[model samples]
Target: MHDATVIGNRLRTLRKWRGLTLVELAGMAGMSKTHLSDIERGLKALDRRSYVASLSTALRVSEADLVGGPHLTQDPVQAGPHSTVPQMRIALQTNTLTEPATDRAREVGILTAEVKQLEDVFARCDYVTLGSRLPGIIDELHFHAARPQNEAAQRDSLTALVEACMYATFRMKDLGYGDLAHQAATRAEEAARLLGDPVALGKAAYCRIQTMPREAGWDRKLTAARRAADTLQPHVRSAEGTAVLGMLILTSALAAAVAYRLDDARDGLAEARDLANYIDDDPCRNWSAFSITNVGAWGVALAVESGESGGAVLEKARIVDESLLLGRPSRRATFLADVGRGLAREQKTAKGALGWMLRAEGVAPQRIRNSPQVREAVAVMIQRSKVAASGRELRGLAARMGIPH
Candidate 1:
């Protein structure tokens, strides 16, 4: 049987349970009565994530129910590498110190190059390769930090450890492992403190801000971000400091947007844009992609997330060259997902939204698969595929993702 028919049946059943007529549900969902009738008759399907979200909201049901299964209920932490934290902690605690002093300078140079390599891999969005490499790098740095022969060597090892842990924190956060990400950030903060590097502390703080609980509220998160950025602003002569401060401000804007504080979001974005003006784009500082163009891209995402929709939001996004976004795979993927969502909010079909989301998935499968938004987008796509022929590709993709047919 066509899966769309099954989805349509479920939706119809839900509406009946609520004692709502087709016209009533359609009115609440802000769709045409005829279109809603077609869906109830299994002649059409829910084709957009926004549509599914809207209908579910109107019906007082979960989106998962409309889609006919609990595809989204899986615990990401249990299903992924969250359990690796204890092992990583053990590696840090048990590593042996570096030996002797003859090749300390050469070894430092090698470790620096390795850190660069790791950053490059991260920029490319090669999470699998990064995951495999992190343990060894963490152990090596810890080993060196434990047994450096002199002060200079100790600083080198400590710095390398901070870099590695920061990368670990970034990857863990991307994968949606909040607790593990927070642990990595904590380790990075400790190392940064021992090194007495203010710039490094700013970076660690940036990672910590993401792992903060939503229960803590946006005011608390924004305050923390403001304090970190303000502290780094005076040290703005250094490129690293400038980048960290700009990013912190940008992050504050994101937090404010999520909390519905549009005024605060605007203020933070303006400050970040001003800071971005004074800083040059440094490729080696991959995290510093907080350029003016990047700020515009983020502005588009923030607008979409705020439930504002019109030609203006998508138009603003269009002016940002796709090439600029491609330089950072994570940013590129997120920007594309936001664009897809904005398109959907504009009443585009599920296929249109899926096109944008699939483009992001093609570049970074882990990113898309791990995203709740993409999962719901895919759920809508699958529901729309009721006729069988039109949804074949999406069905194949869903099968690969272990979404039940």
Candidate 2:
């Protein structure tokens, strides 16, 4: 494993590069000087999204710059996903809506099927397979979308292109290519606008919201989500529309939670719950996976983001049907990881937190290993571990994360 890098070390380096004192940087970031000192000295974990956003904005760098990402590694299993990113970047950069970089493409029907298969791989959090397959599919879909044989073929190709770009947006963002993610999201939005389906447009809006700049204010994200949901309101008579709207509401809830607006966050969650009650099936499967089960998972995440205690988050988790989450491995892994993060906040429950994180890793090793939150949680547990057996387990996990133990 490569030597681990911590946010504190990066923060200190960036601060010095900018020639700013602790007091100056803290004032710029809207944090106390003492707090900034603690974060720089590695006495505190830079885990909160808001803090990361503020500091990145203050430092004039990306969130990934502070967090140290696109974590390249020697382990083949882990390195496979990162290797494909260069080709993915080239594909996105070279292709345009009017002209595809590649001339060869499969039939529209075959391309659609391939896109659907990739979607399933994405749900399973199989990043290696997804990354390897995405560039070709994206190029092919763009080709078909640009010059279709007929009107029906054009619509089908455009829809498939929208979905493919959505997947690309998510993959790029997860891999720490924020600019590529934004570019993909823009392509999705363009395709959706051409398709002119409200649900497709809603999905595109969600992708755009997800890829918003890390320094973007939480209020801006909340407003964008709410506005998108409202625009989709008249079309929610269908299950797909309802599910998409529900996802937008949940996004709003998360933004509000991060902004520390408890009442607004609860309102958004309540609205999403009502929408979830209307859909009996996973109508947004290829998109948001919006369902009652998904809603419950979002509730647990909301509780954690709102700074709830471990017991409170666990209480929320009890209502979620983990069995239902089996169909969506990424969601399952994220829910379990959120539970782990919540538990890790308290010293008394920190040891138990490792169990949930390990379960999440079992579900999605690539996702868990790449996650900044998971890395921070492991570091925290290592600091708090007192028992020899638990310490050994924590060290093993840290080693897997390439963190010094």
Candidate 3:
């Protein structure tokens, strides 16, 4: 039997439950009846964020309902990373800016070093370690920031808290704890505002945009990214400022592309490329990963979202310096998974898409397993696979993602 949790199954069930026909849902979502039908039948991949956002809006449900998020699995490797979410949530909820939940904390310098180490862990996509360590770090940082011994110590503690909270935001989001992720983002923004640092505030803005409700708010997300980018443009004389500004522009480009604004997306990409030319690829710099190669990686995603042909998308992916992506497993895996997603759109290239996805999984198993886009692409490819070898390969991937094949 086909899995009831697959996006197609969920979509069909939701539509019927709402007493809507395919034509009605499609009309509401700004798509054709035939397209909606294909999606319901699993012939078409429901991989586009824009499509999910539209359908969720039309159905008056959250995007997570359609995507079946907070996906629990028995496999330890896949399920282990999510184990710490409850603890992290408690820490975030119980703590405050003026009064932290913890009473004692290490020195500011030690906490700062630990935060840096956790940032490295994040870059490697080591979510298990990242999640396990975050709650303690968060509480400690909060204690230090809230109970500062001196003005300099207070500034240092607040700065470390912002970075720690940002890391927590990323971890929560990746593990599908959207509400917790938003709380983490809010904490980060609060710390940045207290510090009165423009770059820190820009980083916090990026975190907020990432955690914004995916069901709607495309315009709000895009506007926020553009406004943050504009505010940071004057600070680009330093590498850190340039990288953060580039990151914001890339965020704008992605928000535009997902909103189906091709012209705006291209303009954003063009502007990002110009900024990227001024800096080197430094994954640690503001954690932006903004560089010429990263811009190319973003281009592949934009092309895929724009409904460009598979060959065209592959052409865009070809120019990105894959070597530059190695240090940041999250960025590297995302780039590879997006390439697979784009190629899986066409039957002619679907067979080859599996290889790229496998590479992505090898780079970051948790990320690939949790990604709705990657999961839907795998489902579509499984439905299309005829050869026994490819079928076996695709089924293995599906099983890893807890999707029955």
In the range 6-97, model 2's lDDT, one tens digit per residue, is 66778999999999999999999889999788777665567778888889889998777788766656555555677788878887888887
lDDT (Cα, tens digit) per residue for candidate 1, span 190-251: 77888888888898899888777544556688889999988877776666677788889988
Give, for candidate 2, the lowest lDDT window spanning 10 residues. 279-288
Clash pairs (backbone) in predicted model 2: none
Runs in model 1 lying further than 4 Å from the true structure: 1-106, 281-286, 309-312, 384-390
The candidate with the higher TM-score, 2 or 3, is: 3
RMSD of each: 7.4, 2.3, 1.9
Give the distance in Å from residue 286's predicted Cα in candidate 2 to where it truly belongs: 7.0
Stretches off by above 4 angstroms in model 2 are 1-3, 15-38, 41-43, 58-61, 281-286
For model 3, the local distance difference test gives 0.85
Clashes in model 1: which pairs? Answer: none
Q: Pick the candidate with the highest TM-score.
A: 3
Worst 10 residues of 1 by lDDT: 70-79
Q: Which stretches of candidate 3 lie over 4 Å from their true place?
A: 1-4, 284-286
List, residue by residue over 1-405, the lDDT tens digit for candidate 3. 123377888899999999999999999999999989888888789988888889998998988888876776676667778877788888899998898998998888998899888877888778888888888988988887788889899898888888888888987888788999999999999999999989888889989999998865677789999999988777656887788888899999989988888899999999999988788765535455788888999999888877774788889999998988888888899999989998898888888899999999999998778777888888877777887878888999988888778
